[model samples]
Target: MTEQTCGVRDVVDLGQDDGDTAEIHDECGVFGVWAPNRDPARMTYFALRALQHRGQESAGIAVGDGKTVLVRKDLGLVTQVFTEADLAAMPGKVAIGHCRYGTAGAKGWEAAQPHLSTIDDTIIALAHNGTLVNFDSLRRELIEMGIPFRSNTDSEVAAKLIGYFTQRGHRLRSGIAHTMRMIKGGYAMVLARENALYAFRDPHGIRPLVLGKLGENEWVVASETCALDIVGATYVRDVEPGEIIRISDDGMRSERGLPPADRHDCIFEHVYFSRPDSIKDGSSFYLMRHNMGRRLARETPVDADLVISVPDSGTPAAEGYAAELGLPYGTGLIKNRYVARTFIQPTQELRQRGVRLKLNPLPDVVRGKRIVMVDDSIVRGTTSKQIVRMLREAGATEVHVRSASPMVKWPCFYGIDTANQDQLIAANMELKEICSYIEADTLGFLSIEGLLSCVPSGGYCTACFTGDYPVEIPKSFYEEKFLPGYTPHNPDPSASDASISISDIAFDLKESENGD
Candidate 1:
């Protein structure tokens, strides 16, 4: 066990560049276990570290020892919290863990999860991934019923609701079923009790939850398949929408409940949210993104000397695009492997600064050449503009931007942290306008058909791009303002108050009823 104390400043010093950025949405990762031969907490810690890219705000683990549950959580990176000694202290064979990025809760220790509850003389610990559109209404109802709340998180409501039902003489699975019926929006949950571990996904499957096997007696549930791979587990299948699976010493059992009339797995999981190595619903994420880049190159051809990727996630797709266009592929940008994800930064200033410190353009390769920069997507245009400016300053003759996914026009009510519609540059601007704003010579985005074709399984949720939600979304759904010390800057006085509230917008179209 290596014992070393390193702070955020020390980590920042290890960054690779000075000025380059990318727009992205923040997400959470969840992992759990039922029965295992080894200490489940240590395995979960490694799994969370593998999924640290999906979230960075906090990391936690809850373990069950057949009679009691023990939990440990804190606000920081996973590596910072779970040391070898910490792992050794957490003794258990069944555990559930979480890596959170605050979709709808305060960014403090209280909101960090694996929320524990004692109801009906049984300890239940929960770790959730996804956002609930009806959180406000649910909170009000729970408060009215005299349920003492400990944290300002939407996930807690689900835990309390399930506890409430279980206390009324309902079976554990029945309580979860009843709670699921009342919730509205996306969720992939892991529920732990004295002797069992349970996993479930929302009816619409807006979020992801996959099942894997470690050994003959051990079963695992994780937000992405990459986690399972890191722990030497074999991918079994995804937890079906509206289905609950229980794992105990006896073995694994499943119950199929009422599924939503529609199914829409989050498309961003393939584009930017998930690790490229992960396999979602039997579809290779790397291949899907690579195919998207290939299609983008065909639809919007650009005369460029070379194609360069933004690094990490963009590298695979850029290679595909270059192959399709017969252009020389070069490493134009170098990423700082040690830099933390900017989207996970709690403050706006920190997010902006993090991006600048994350990536740098390689002047030798891009200088005196026409560069086609391939990236996954652009959200607010802040990162895109900065990256374009960096390339030009680095002596690139012309910079052409290519996006592997369609433009994001609508705020996601499922789980992603895309709250304000106005903040989205693509939502209000045309393609030419967006290109001009980003100062790019040319800009191209993947078409809807191209995105759908990329997926081998032929099912995805592109609601953020096309406004086609798979379930009945709340008209008033919006991300809850929960970051403790963070606040938005007020708009200029001279500007008109064109901001629209959630209730006024008619989000549901007639096509939503058709369940496409």
Candidate 2:
């Protein structure tokens, strides 16, 4: 395997606007291709490059040459992990790739995915883009059967389930179908076995996944349509929640794993996760963000001379706010894109210097004037405080901070990186307290109503704001979900092994690894 590094001076992690404090991240991205007579691995590489915004810590691509599954993954950006020669060496008819931020499990080379496992002889490689809430339950169940796991990642748990089910006389479809029911929480996954590519989503469709046509019969499945665009594929449609699609040289066949239920696709995609050029749930990403900024302006108008963004993610919202309020918009913060994830553990001094390292206030824009700052969300309140201080230091007479989305007060167990609610400033502080905490003259957030006005309410997950989870999470799971190093024990320790039956988990292998 070859490793490469292009001379990219500045590479920042994507989908994280909250700086320093509780860097809210989208978590992971998955991409795959099924193209006969073509180098599927190469296409997957490029597609993963486009979806890199979704993940940054590690990358891998697995290719199936109709007989053997080959995998290479390590902790790094896509560009740093794979070279052109590496892609050329793993030529195959089908390929699946992953860029990981690790929503669940520890971060390491061992945990980096496109997790490869053998379904007896038919090798399968899988990439995942979400967390599984039933992790402890499933792990303990499998452990009871003496089935050991290879990694700490929940994706490995999924791979083990597939391998076990396939080994137990279930067809690839049936195996995946059963596995889907056993798993819970948000996920968009791509798996390749022997000769076919399979993609599926959570029953609630808590994460985004879309299908696209490359040329003629060749197809693509990915976490976002933006990946499809990068690979020169024509967008098809989103994979229906709880639906499974298997792609091969013959064609594509689909089946449902779970019946259509209350759709709860993550609302964060339109708010901040996706690229503005991309589309989600038939809505334009740019328009959604623009409309959010529009609603934010109307709902939370502040007296200020000019509007400015917190650099990149906040740009569209700042522009919309400026236009809506009839105030001039200007670039008050200059971002140095080259400075990305630093290796050193930031000291308190270094952390305090965080804003200057990435963003420098353009004094000329804010000098002796009132300024309005528009940002996506406030996570820990530290970043907002730093930003307000930066603006004040730049000669702004007053600073008003406006957030496009409602305050994120709850932990997102679906796929977001927020681990504990205790870290959320909104979860703890009132608006006036938050304003004082951030050191801003005023602070306002778009109401849930105002935020929903920007997009259709149906199928959108607003559990972060409303706390009404579409899928019921066991109360046993919450405190353990974010509290690090917590061990799992039955709520009733008196429970017997008979509590979870393995009678349905058979061990026979006589079905096709693919539909073929």
Candidate 3:
């Protein structure tokens, strides 16, 4: 194992124009490979780079040789964390990798994964994506049972839980199944041992996990297809909800860890988290976003001479909007792609110049133009406000702001790190008030129905937009966080066992340990 350090820096991407707030962040990305003849560690590094958009705070890889497990991780972007020497030193047949943007733990070296733990006599490393809501109580129970912990992350809790169960006489897959039934919330996890790889997902399927074929016997699993493409693998299928897939010299096997619940895939993947080149639900994210823009234009038409996007994230939608209305489409702003992170602390005066550091207006494209600026979503409205002002100052005659998705009014508990309700500008301000706040001549958000129509047909957890959650949240976890008069809708109360007693759980484990 090896570790390195640097000051904790905030990564600015997507709609984080001001750099003060990242409107939203997917929890992390996970990738694992089971290819004996291949350079699995190098494959994992390339895969993590492909999934880098999902996380930027940390990157790590754990490789399992025939005899032991080795891990190298640190707090930084993937490019900064590992080098050719590091990868060349760790030769292994199986490996799991992680890139994290923490939504459930502190931003420290210990919180970065793939988290290492021991299961009886063997070493195992686990990489996880998504937040586990009931982890605090689980952590306490494990601690009471003499289990030690090094970090406050739910990922570590999951690792220790699997270790605890496996130490008690059950097979590793059975232990994983037991852990799956206990933890609640959205998650997709990949675990690596000395000679094998295992991948699993939550019952509700709130997070994504896909399996791919490297050749014949070699198999790989990752958070997105783009990762598979980067590693020269062929898409196989999604690891179904509540399913456990194990790959090794034994080939591949799958079984139900828990009965699959109603699907509640995160809809925000289409909005921002996924790269445009990524494929989801039989369509490229680019096509889905393009359809969203077309739907948004029909629903909220504005008088404008040109249509522009918040660069990169919003480009597809803006192009579709221009095509639908026969309006001219041009690049009004150019982004400084090099501005991924800053090492120096930003002063209050420097903070005011935040948006300018990442994006600049092209006067030639927007001058004398009545511009409609399209963005993926508006959470706090700070970035949108700065971008709008920048366009106006660049000689735009009038500026109208359009959000491609519905207003994000509620906090997300699945995996996305959204602001508190009071901090969410859309939750507090009316449409007109938000328009005034951002200093735009007009502002419009796509309706929930309109937004859903643009994506593939499936159940989605739109909790951030409509306060509808697929899994039940513990009252203790969210009672104080929800705004007054807002009732969270949990469609299926029977789906979650978060309130299950710890004593009953302990007793069950004891019975299993005794071969009852």
**Predicted model with the maximum TM-score:** 3
Q: How many Å off is the CA of 236 in candidate 1? A: 0.9
Residue lDDT tens for model 1, 139-216: 777787788888888899889877876665347887787677667778999989878899988977889999999888
Clashes in each model (backbone N, CA, C under 3 Å)?
0, 4, 0
Better of 2 and 3 by TM-score: 3
Question: Per-candidate RMSD vs. true structure?
Answer: 11.6, 9.0, 7.9
Residue range 1-516, candidate 2, lDDT tens digits: 122221111111111123234457887899989997788888888998898888889999999998899998988888889988898799889999999888788888889989987777788999999888777778778878888877778899888888778767547777787677677778899999879999999888898899999887799998888899888898989999999999987799999987866788898887888888888667778788888888788777767899999877788888888988899999999989876553556789977686677788999899999999999887788777788888989999888888888888777887888767778787776665677677777677878877777886676888787666665555666865533432222234232122333335452233333334
Residue pairs in collision within model 3: none
Angstrom error of the Cα, residue 501, model 2: value is: 4.8
| Model 2: lDDT to the true structure | 0.80
Sorted by TM-score (best first), the order is 3, 2, 1
lDDT of 3: 0.86
Q: Mark the regions of model 3 whose C-alpha exceeds 4 Å error after superposition.
A: 1-22, 491-495, 499-503, 513-516
Stretches of candidate 1 exceeding 4 Å from the true structure? 1-22, 341-354, 478-516
Global local distance difference test of model 1 = 0.78
- Choose the strongest candidate by lDDT: 3
Q: Could you tell me the TM-score of candidate 3?
A: 0.94
